[model samples]
Target: MSVEIKISLNKGLYLKEPQDSKLGRKMIKHSIMLIEKFGFEAFTFKKLAKEINSTEASIYRYFENKHLLLLFLVNWYWEWVSYLITMNTMNVIDPKLKLKIIIHSFVAAHKENPNVEYVNESKLHNIVISEGMKAYHTKDVDSENSKGFFKSYKNLTTSVSKVISEVNPDFKYPYALATNLFEMSNNSIYFAQHLPKLTDISLKENKVVEVEDMLLYFTNKLLKK
Candidate 1:
């Protein structure tokens, strides 16, 4: 994974120098700002264009639509996390420790890019939940769009399962376990703030077991026979 001269997938195309980078960062920054100012339900192309000091046509060059823009914003964080993960384990070979360090590295990745950690994650959640609710409640459901989103989510879950298997080979229902693990971790924050009753008491604790801890513990409990 000794990758060099990395270019973020979500960054805008073309430009002379670091302005491209700044402009790209501003897009993500403004996206967060807009989402906060007007919840996902109220988000509009015109608002984003105005906030970024660009026209809808210009923004369209980078993102085809609002959904895609949110997807890019969400994916950017994972891509950055992957980059950080590769950077941390130069000589580490032990699988279990690798996963643990991966957890540590995840937190460090957040530290490295706080924008995605704090801002975009919230926006990402809002977008995801809103769309999901829309599809759920709507009668004519855009089958294509729902299927596409579900497919991407499935792949993401499978990827997490594979990572779990890499650390401990015998975890039963790897993907299912991974799904519960990850879905709980992500939703805990979003849900706890609202439906605290649906959450377990452990999630209420000040010192809680994080997603990585749950994954690592599941690995040890199920695989270390």
Candidate 2:
């Protein structure tokens, strides 16, 4: 069964909400495909407009620039993962178990969800792994942060951090650990696939059990103390 998910993101990220119109949605759908195919630096409004059968001016109507468009996609991804965590951990009372489920959700969220026909979660996950940091690692990040542009990512971290606190109230670095686990899930997979020397896990075909096991191992070891 496929359910429609509507994720509300920061208004500052776009001049117009891309989800509200067919052309806007087409712009987003192709933006992801273009970015994933050519990488972010090579992606441009001109190319996107050509690919989507729209004009550069039309693309500009939806987004101020390509950077903001990237941020919008990245923020959407963070919210999706957060939603998955909620769904996966629902009614699970054990904090340790909930944390375990979070690890699974982090890994599993990379898989495609049929519900969101426009956004390919798998390709978006790859984009997040490779190009996500560019969204905030900029001189303008502080100004953007002031406008709540990064709230979706922060909210995802906070939610996981709360579960970490529940598992061990005395754990002093819940937020750090929470964010690290999520980053590690993405990083380790990227490393295994492209830079195998950096990670101990070996990449296999369409499976990430090693990444899940490694995250669970670390979480258990850290929280057991």
Candidate 3:
């Protein structure tokens, strides 16, 4: 498959933009609504423009195509997740505690973003850390098809791994744990048929909090070993 990419490395982030800016906040917000309503594949410049009360040409002026729009949306999620982890775990001096907090945050966000793109976002981080992203962009790259779609995943792993190392001076296989965390969190929410539903609570309702509780429970249990 010929994958067409649409990211502007030079563009400002949507999360930080002013709400009323023409090609900034309002656009991002509306675009998200469009995605939430129809998913990323069904989202088109014509359809999104109609929903946002704008022209297709105007939408194109910001994003060249759906792929780029997807890249933008994926980047927004990573930035927001990174910001939340930093803000929430800043004061904790214990690396182990910080790791716990970070895991808590990841599980919470997984429950929060619950979509195909955010799932793609999970892959993106792994790719970034492994330099698989650069390979994807390379014309001479081999077996690029199996390389997966994550461009930001490596950074996510590095960040998470660093915290893991902090938690346990002897921690091995940080990336494996990162991968597991991503799979576990993502599966629990998005891939619901394979996941068992809750007893007295709904995973659909209070997702983040429930994920947080689960993460804390897992960490406390595992760390005791």
Candidate 4:
């Protein structure tokens, strides 16, 4: 039996929840595919509508605009990652082992989940690495931030930061280190694939062990007392 996981997101992100109906679910399924294939700059409601065999107006009924749709997808990824970390670390008594598990979860999040039929997590992960920053790197970020648009990402950071504090209560920058590790996991893979000179790991096939090794190496050295 495949258990469906429901991730509740901010209500303000969409005029209508995409998971509530067949059409809405189709919209999300095709949007992630289209965005991952063409990049966000070229993705629009018309393209999504055509890909899903729906009308542009129908997509607008669900999302206010493309940017909001992107935010919704990006936020969903953050919450998914947070869930992975929790599930992977559950009942693990050792803080060091838990942290290692957390790092592995971050790298392994790109793998497809059979439970989430609508969202192709591997493609969604590619979208996140390539386009996630645009969700918040905007002039209206302050306004959106005030509306709790970034709560998912912040909560994920806070949870990992707690684990870091457990590992070393005296560590001065637990939150910073937590966020850095998360960002580094994504950034390193992005660099390895596109800008090879910028990263030490080489992108060959779909394997990510080298990336995981590099992250663990950094984590061990930085947290060493």
Candidate 5:
């Protein structure tokens, strides 16, 4: 059975929360689908408004600009990932296994959640892989950081860092490893798909398992004291 999940993102990522109204929700739903369909660079409020039969000003009321909307979607993706890690690890006793599960969750092909039809998680995962970094790689990043724009990502790294510490209390670079694991999880697949020479893996059948195994191996070796 597929479980339904509600994702709440950091407030600073949006001018007004989209979940508060029907049109607001529709905006998010269509935005996710459109962003996945068209790359983020080509996505715009005018296009979104036309798709939803609403005015661009209506979207502006919820978001200051397209950047904020993209940030909100990416932030929501990270929070959803964190939620999955927490839910999957609950009641597990082994730290190593818990970390393994976390690594696997990061690279695994996303499945659509039937209950949450508005957000196609599978497409969202692909969007994150392709355009997630654009949300933070800008001149305004410093100002955004000061406003807690990257809290979900930070929390995600911290969550895995804790697991690393659990396995080895003396491990000195938990945060670094945690962040690296997160980056590499998406990066390996990105490289494999777009720049095959950069990665040994491929998008061939069971390649996800290979990537997962590579991550687990790296993580286990690093966490092993």
Candidate 6:
């Protein structure tokens, strides 16, 4: 299947929809690069504005703060991931195979998308590994949750949990497993690259292959009757 370049994001993620305007698109595109380059702590609207040759005030018109911008970017990524999972597993009837396909698609998501010019999937994956959780780890998490700020992520988890149920109706931890599957996909990569001591996988080797193997092994081992 062809890679989709554009996906509609939740309105709650942004003060103004970046995908709606040329400058907004530049803000989103440059912000991804800047966040990946400097990490979320050092990334700012002023830095982003300089990178995009726009004013910080213009950027603020779209996002109330840098935290919200990160939320928007990270949520956009999760929605894309949710789409990829659905498209790839739609035709597969076997629950085990569907789970395997989900794992593989996630490993592949660490790579760049040639068709999507506005955002780099690979860089976005790094941001997710490093800073994605901060989006929800705020004092306003309850308020954001009430606003459906995490709907895309929850939808993805729910989708994966359904496959877990199909694989083993008696499994008591489908939601836990589903959410771990999502985090492990990125966390494993992060550990492999930055904290090799935390993981058995090595960055010198094909990290994606190692992560896929490890995920499949644990998943199959856990799900097997």
Cα lDDT listed for each candidate? 0.54, 0.91, 0.54, 0.91, 0.86, 0.86
User: What is residue 185's positional error in candidate 6, in angstroms?
Assistant: 1.3
The parts of candidate 1 lying over 4 Å away from their true place are 1-7, 10-24, 104-109, 114-163, 201-216
Per-candidate RMSD, Å: 6.0, 1.1, 9.5, 0.9, 1.8, 1.7
- TM per model? 0.64, 0.97, 0.65, 0.98, 0.93, 0.95
The collision pairs in model 6 are none
Stronger candidate by lDDT (1 vs 2): 2
Count of steric clashes across candidates, in order: 0, 0, 13, 0, 0, 0
Model 4: lDDT of residue 200: 89
lDDT of 1 by residue, 73-111 (tens): 555545555556566665777766666666554423434
Residue 22 lDDT, candidate 2, scale 0-100: 93
Task: In angstroms, give how far residue 187 of model 5 lies from its true place.
Answer: 1.1
The reply for model 6, stretches above 4 Å from the true place, is: 1-5, 112-114
Sum up the clashes in candidate 4.
0
Clashing residue pairs, backbone N/CA/C < 3 A, model 2:
none
Global CA lDDT computed for model 3: 0.54
* lDDT, candidate 5, 1-225, per-residue tens: 676667877787777888878888899899998998999989999999999999999999999999999898889888888987888899998999899889888986375253676777878888888888899999999999999989999999999999999999998999999999888888888888889899877777635887888888887787777
Report the C-alpha displacement of residue 36, candidate 3, in angstroms.
0.8
Q: How far is candidate 2 from the true structure (C-alpha RMSD, Å)?
A: 1.1
**Model 3: CA > 4 A from native:** 1-20, 109-152, 193-204, 216-225
For model 4 the TM-score comes to 0.98
